[model samples]
Target chain A: MSGREAILGNIRKGLKRSGPLAGTALELCQTRLREHRPNLIPARAQLPHAGQVELFVQMAQEASATVARVTERAAVPAEVARYLADIGFAAEAIVAPDASIAGLDWSAAGVATEARHARNGDRATVAPAFAGIAETGTLMLLAGPQSPTTLNFLPDAHIVVLDAARIVGPYEDAWAMLRSERGEGWMPRVVNWITGPSRSADIEQKLQMGAHGPIRLHIVLIGD
Target chain B: MQITSPRFKQNAHEALGDAALQRALGNLKAGFPGKRAAAVARMPEFEQLRDAARDLKNHILEHLDFYLETFEANVKRRGGHVHWARDAEEARAIVLDICRKAGAKTVTKGKSMITEEIGLNDHLAANGIEPIETDLGEYIIQLRGEHPSHIIAPAIHVNLDQVSDAFHAHHGKYGKTERQTEPRALMNEAREILRDKFIAADVGITGANFCIAETGTTVIVTNEGNGDLTQTLPRVHVAVTSIEKVVPTLEDATLLHRLLSRSATGQEIEVYGTWSSGPRRPEDPDGPAEYHVVLLDNGRSNMLGNEFREMLRCIRCSACMNHCPVYGAIGGHAYGWVYPGPMGSVLTPAFIGVEQAGNLPNASTFCGRCESVCPVRIPLPKLMRHWRAREFEKHLTPQGFRFGLGVWAWLARRPKLYRLATQVATRVLKPLGGKTNRIGSLPLAGGWTAWRDLPAPQGRTFFEQWKDRQQAGGAK
Candidate 1:
């Protein structure tokens, strides 16, 4: 039998095993669809292109407010160097080597840039994802030539330079885009979808950000 | 050892009525739904994800037998044993045999609904093997010798004081005085206690959130990190999962994962999402020497090829439970089963005969909130109706209720007689309503009237008012 036919046959077997009751199941499915209507947020809001990224950055800032450190998105190597110098982390900040920042004159930019290697007690630098999700306000870091999952999670304050043009409408659209780009062979070992800093409400249901993951998140929405 | 649904009800009542339980339940009401809303609001694609997840689950359930065979074959190929259990008794027996063969003195477990269904812990303890619950909430319930109150947050009904007390009582024997008065302190105490058990455990048993057939991987999501230690540290790791937990491929698992965590606790993803392929791979360092996957039927296979096949699509995110007004009010323990809320109400009746669990189906208000919040989109309310139908067919309902329902149905079938009876009843009862137009007590609705006063009907029926309106059209 074909793959589709085999699948259909199995479903028949599963249904027989599970039992029958079509009328009841249909009614229940309809009821579920109705209830989630209000809770669902629409894809489009009345915000301008710049405002959307700014809104995401603002929300991330609010969610990660408890953390002591935060990074803003830097457009160029010079701006990145300036930010690091301002924070007094220029001497020690470890930079992740990705294609976006590869040709930028880092030596003239006046700060040390390190390759994407695991380092202790140094702030790791990496490129911001193409488009960040506004709904979860998540930073979608795909492991490729430019971005690594470790740079986003391991560092004290992750500095992500997000290009405003890459922001998509929804997560499914984003996944569909990724699937097209990545193709079918050997999927990335890690695709980190970071929503705010690592948080836990385990203790007395009090919202405590930064339990095990990153303590701080900084997003720089570069309007080119 | 067979504690029926009625027994669970009595136990839950005793637990839920306590002041501590009420306090814990209040925390749940404020925390879960609020966070879920915030998470969903931040992601515009969440609805699309939910739809995709639901479709994927429906597709898998349609071809579950094929997936099961593929999963079983893949598991065996990876040097993992696959056991198919036709019922709860068989499942329990299979697990017990594995434990007996290994001569497991002590077993450490992660949270699993199937184990609850099979009463594995109780069975093991009866046969003289100590099954230790390593999950913080599960450990609390285990110490108290009670079943999990909720699927996600097992001890959600338990307050901090109760947790402290359970720790004080159970921790002293482990050479530690329970100084923990706070939740974090209690968690720290548990972490330390369970750490030792994890290392010394001969067998580690956990429940799979999703079992991928393509890779023969059993996926488990937990925030506490206890499941990882339980599976990796032990010599033998046994995964007990229901048939519905199987998905066709890893990609499908990922799609479901995106929906599962969001619907479960409103997180983009859980803190830990681990996928165990089989017994420790040859190159792997520090993993289980022996891996076993027990695929349990327990009346689930019967659900397939039927109208209720959609029920198998459930990812067990507990979204339905969190949104359910009944569950919110009384908590999971009140449902009197491992799978609580709307899903449990439908499932319990199916697993243990509709006659045995007639009240479970009737417990709901048919508010449809549970169905709405469900990620895989199980039509729980309609399933409850099916159970009700079964109850009526089997004559399981109380004779008085059955007779009253029969009379009501007969009257409902004849509208003219129903209108006449209503008119006469309105006339008779209007005086008893008094000036306030409310009855202090209802005659037959004993439980309904016990809580609140019943509002009295209007003196004139709708039909009477309509007839008067028709006649008074200027006598035309």
Candidate 2:
């Protein structure tokens, strides 16, 4: 028998389920996974939409991320340019090829943009987030052809364009949104829930930013 | 990797004497607990969340076989492979096979306790494959050829000067020989050095914090994002986790995630909570081309059918150890294994035989602080007591202790005899105590007296006080 069979057999013997798993037991297991009910969401996460957006911005700042608000999608490039200049960075960055972000005119905003996966030497990366979670100020990015996962981690600065309308309260809501959009029982190769810029407290338990991922996380919230 | 748990006393003695380790340990004592306390005080529903997390884990462990099968099938559906290993040797061999198939000369590693448990690095090095540890703490320990003193903070036992010296000694060949004392400078130096390794590595290995059975997703929580970089840059990705790490659904992972960060660190959420389901998809622009997960059983299967089964509920928050007085005194290395502190004390005896690690369970004072702060409420003190009971039953405890307990038990059977024994001892001790009202030293109590004087028992026994209260009530 394979190692899988042996380990499973050991588990069965130990748990005292001597026979093959009966249909009822299997059904209960499947039902639990299928229903996937969330338990005890914090009261703070159950706020109204406006309250959520406010909390998202507040919590994001508390997590050490800078936030900018744009009244329209057309203003994203300008906001991006302003942020780059504010940080004294060159007006150039790699952007994800998501359709939501693909139509923006980078040159019109006076910023040079490369639409591809993030390269190791890339200093800044701009991608469109799948959703923004308000409960903890986390940005949810799914990995696929549209938004490569490397853009979230490889660059020193991560700039995300999140549609303010897509912001949700709890992580469960984000997962629910994921299922509704991508279909149940399906996910991309990866889903990154980035709360803030990378940090490390490994040395003497001192907080240091830019340990391995982006040092700065800048989010541009675009209103509907 | 060798079990020095049998020599816990000797290890703790050495650890206590090391001035550098003592200084580092002082920071650990002051660091994690207060942060956790503050985080808990901020969240009103934190206790409710702990209960929810514990119940979910208990439900999952009961149906783990079914969940594992479902997780395996889902992984296969996503074009990933799941390998099961009954023991550490098999697990190590499985990982090596993957590396060999990819013709990997070098592998970058995220911080993984499972890899350390299975001795994966040494095994890979023995097979001529160099493993680069990318996590800053793990990297420092790697340079010094030492094991992690603390699980989360691998270099928790090493002071800053030691880190600077290690970097200076090792990074000289990279043409950077300057000695830096600031933590930020050290972090930057390590980042610069590991950045090249991340790009050059052919394979990346990480440990899963939780595996979602519903989606075949492996979750890794890291503040440094080394795990993300390690898995993202390499062509092949492997997640080595034990069978117990699997949870039934994303909701379960969410609930545990809420409790884990608060208990482990003060963060409401860690910086990077990345979920990788499989290899890079067909339409994915970047990610590993191959993904594998090795599910290790070792002795966890045995732990499932017994009293110690609740240990599997651990989310590895390190809250228990952070609150443990014994751990704060001796640090992690003194426990002498891959794991340390209260959780390790209970688990070490289970993994290695009780005979080898019996001393670990005895090291506790049963303060219950570990259980109080445990995110999943694992009842750590109760489990340690179980180990102590088993040791006593098997005659593994010292004969003197057994005889002492036996004498106490004999006297306790008769209430009159017990009361007389205690009353006579109290009277004899009062005169000995004198004006200081403390015992300087006594036979068979050197352990307590050596540290400090014991306060004299000047008052009447509880039975006498209770009787007097009853008579006074009757008079009233």
Clashing pairs in 2: none
Fnat of each prediction, in sequence: 0.12, 0.85
List residue ranges in candidate 1 displaced over 4 A. Answer: A1-224, B7-17, B100-103, B462-476
Assess the local accuracy of residue B395 in candidate 1 as a C-alpha lDDT between 0 and 100.
Answer: 82
Model 2: per-residue lDDT, tens digit, B1-476? 77799899999989889999899998888888889888888789999998998899898888889889888999999999999999889999999999999999999999999999999999999999999999989999999999998888899998889999999999999888889899999998888889999999999999999998999999999999999999999999999999999999988899999998999987899999999998987777889999999999999988889899999999888989888999998999999888899999989988887899999999988989999999998999899999999999899989889999999999999889999999988887777777999988977799889778988888678888899999999998
Candidate 2 residue-wise lDDT at A88: 92
Instruction: Give the TM-score, chain B only, in order for the candidates.
Output: 0.92, 0.98
Q: Top model by lDDT, which number?
A: 2
Candidate 1 docking quality: incorrect, acceptable, medium or high: incorrect
Tell me how large the interface RMSD of candidate 1 is. 8.4
- The local distance difference test score of each candidate is 0.69, 0.91
